[model samples]
Target: MKTNVAQLIELPKFLDKRGNLSFIEEFKHLPFKIERAYWVYDVPGGEVRGGHAYKDNQEFIVALSGSFDVLLDDGIEKKVFSLNRSYYGLYIPKGIWREISNFSTNSLALILASTSYNQEDYIYDYNYFRNYMHEKD
Candidate 1:
């Protein structure tokens, strides 16, 4: 598995006088099928979230309301992605550590996941995640 598989994806958008609309279809815009969806909202400024890595699940994160930054680490390198547009999203592949921070006021984060909630698939410790990556190599 490649370490730097994370990337930004743009969704289809239609502009109108009433308002703007964007839509994402599973397996069309994303590489994986969408099985679950959730959102994060009302996060305080400068707060951080998602200090873990998924073993099998993939995720796509979008800023539905405001702006925020996603820190991605592949155990050897790190990168930061800013999501401010509703039509754009960050696609996170499996086995990469992710942290969301630097949230703007009233930012809404919508996350589309490839799987349902599974506690056993998550690796929350940084040291353990590095070890897992090393084993994969």
Candidate 2:
């Protein structure tokens, strides 16, 4: 898998006098089918999350409220993405190590996954992830 396959996705947004609305469709806004959906919220100050890669699961991460940064490492390069909009998201392909940090207060992170929860699909150790990338090459 190419490390640069990760991309930023912009969803359809509609502005109204009352409020703004945005929606995401599986296989339309995202490149894959939606099988699982979850959110991370109420994270305390200076707290961080996600330090692993998925062997097969791809993810689309969106900030529903507040802001946060996603650090993506492809074993050769690293990039930081700041998400602060509900209509925008980060598409994380499989085999890329990712970390979420620098969260603003009361930030809500919504993650849409392409697959269900599977323990065997996760690569938690950085060294193991590097080896896995080497093997893929």
- Tens-digit lDDT string for candidate 1 (17-91): 999999998878788889999999988877899999999999999999889999999999999999999999899
lDDT scores in order: 0.92, 0.93
Q: Candidate 2 lDDT, tens digit per residue, 1-137?
A: 23349988888999999999999998788888999999999988888899999999999999999999999999999999999999999999999999999899989999999999999999999999999999999
- Error at 45, model 1, angstroms: 2.0
Q: Model 1, which residues run further than 4 Å from truth?
A: 1-4
TM-scores, each model vs. reference = 0.95, 0.96
Q: Worst lDDT window (10 residues) for model 1?
A: 1-10
Least accurate stretch of 10 residues (summed lDDT) in model 2? Answer: 1-10
